[model samples]
Target: MKHGLLWIARALGLFALCSWLTRRELRILCYHGIWDGPGHYGNYLFMSPGKFRSRLAFLQDWGARVLPLPVALERLAQGRLPARAVVITIDDGWASTVAHMVPALEQAGFPATLYVTSYYAHNQRPVLNVALAYALSRWAAGERDSTLLPLPGLGQLNCPAGDAIALHRATDQVIEHASTLADDDARQAFLCSVISATGLAQDPVWGGPAFRLASRDQLREASAKGIDLQLHTHRHRTTCNGTSCLAQELADNRSWLTGVGEGPFEHFCYPSGQYQASDWEVLRRQGIESATTTEIGLCRRGENPYALPRILDGESLSELELEAELSGFLTMLRRISRR
Candidate 1:
């Protein structure tokens, strides 16, 4: 009942705000994986493909102008986009995108930007989303009991139910410890250590099917279908750790993308959108034309290209809700500014 009331209040607020938008702003919607089956709660990480298709259809029927990322950027630069212009972007080249989103995009005739991690492309490794889901599921199932485990930099991560805050703190420590690893082997070793220490490896779900990344063939197919393949770092490293490491990640991704014929890749989505000012400089030095962050807002003319904002889409939004949300983007921005 509380959740329903909150939704009702938000809808009323959105309606009021939409009545006052300037009528020229554009909203860029960002998405990640599209799943097909029952999903876990708190896993806003993936949206079912059917729901995604319905949302796209709603946008199309409502006269929303769907533009590619490059075209939208060009329009924003020249101040020439239609009043309802919107750009659709998908981050993390998940296999589900190839299996599900591609057909819907092709049928709808919508062009999109896909940001991929070159390491995952080359190694076919599991991504952070998959790992997070695995870890959370294991914790919930009581398969992982308390154990002492040594992290690389931070000491240990303990597993204990009803200690969510402590668990998150330990998880952060483990993440930081693993971030310093030079290669996938080292990183995986660190992750395994964490799993063993937290006693999470005992969970049946951990032994079950792990999510898969997109294959080279899938990426090539997407490229052939006019989806712009862009850089998302080599290993999806968070930038808050160190600028030098972030710079190396950007450089490595640029080289890898070019070598794999995924270029001329000009746009970059920060690995996890956790960047600092120096990180932007590193991207600039790497010759990135534009970069996207998880921040939510509409792009305006003269706005900084290096730190542009994006609205993340997940499972929570229904077709009608998504339409209303997209329609209210400019209105929300204006309302926030007035306050």
Candidate 2:
């Protein structure tokens, strides 16, 4: 009932009025990675390229005025935002930003910010979560003996070494293993080895070298093509790593990112949306203009720029659901429902 009403309200131009009235704020759309081909299953890091294109079309057809993130923030601060203004921000600089997402955004003429997590860029490994999920998927697809399976650093699981059903029982072990790694490179190596031992693929993940952060060539080329490469952190670590550790990560991130990225790096996205309130002090000290979180809300003026909220856009959010959210009706409903 509520969804239908929201859709009707959007069609009837009610939210259009809201957009006009609320032009002082901005609607920031956050996305992760984009997959090129169909090897990834259950990978929430990105959507398929086809799906991503369709989303851009939806925003255009719905009359959204897409702006680069930094430009949008500046306009909002000046109280000169356009009605129906939206900003595109893709977190985690995967190679797909060059292979798949860039062409699509160029086609739509939409400017986007690609926040690169520097550790993967600095080291020679793919992101850990991708490797972890890949190993689990590989284990689940093959036949093996009925015995306990052991994982390094993440403890042992009673997973049937050769049975899909039994392997399915050990899924949580994969997730826990990925999270406990010392750093991004360590996690990548550990998980990639697991995939190799399982005989998952002859070529291995990211076509072997295609994974990891955007290569220096990719970063240089992307910036030349008008796509913005920004900061996600040197290691995608947040305040959970202690203040000094976090500071080092930022300094390292800015150093390498500026080495390849165009001009100054002023924006940030909390790695995996994990952060503490005191992290703002670190951001301000670094001269960050804005920082986005996984928190759900619209960005209003005078809000803490370091802790701004964003709506996570992914496969889990269907087109209709996205329409409702972008229409800004769902936020209104939540406010009334809470009342």
Task: Tell me the TM-score of model 2.
Answer: 0.85
Give the best candidate by TM-score: 2
* Candidate models: Cα lDDT each: 0.70, 0.75
- Number of clashing residue pairs, candidate 1: 1
The 10-residue segment with the lowest total lDDT in model 1 = 36-45
Where in model 1 is the C-alpha error above 4 Å? Answer: 1-22, 36-38, 128-133, 141-163, 177-183, 186-210, 238-241, 259-262, 318-321, 329-338
* Root-mean-square deviation of Cα positions for candidate 2 versus the true structure, in angstroms: 3.7
Candidate 2: misplaced stretches above 4 Å?
1-21, 39-44, 141-156, 159-189, 196-199, 202-210, 240-244
Candidate 2 lDDT, 1-339, residue by residue in tens: 867876788789877766565566688888877765446544357688788899999999989899998888888888888877899888888877778888889889999988888777666566666666656766656576634446666555666545566665576667666677787567667776676656665644447434566787787788888888887888778655344466777888889877687868888888888878788898888888889998876788777898887767887677877776676666666667989
Cα lDDT of candidate 2 equals 0.75
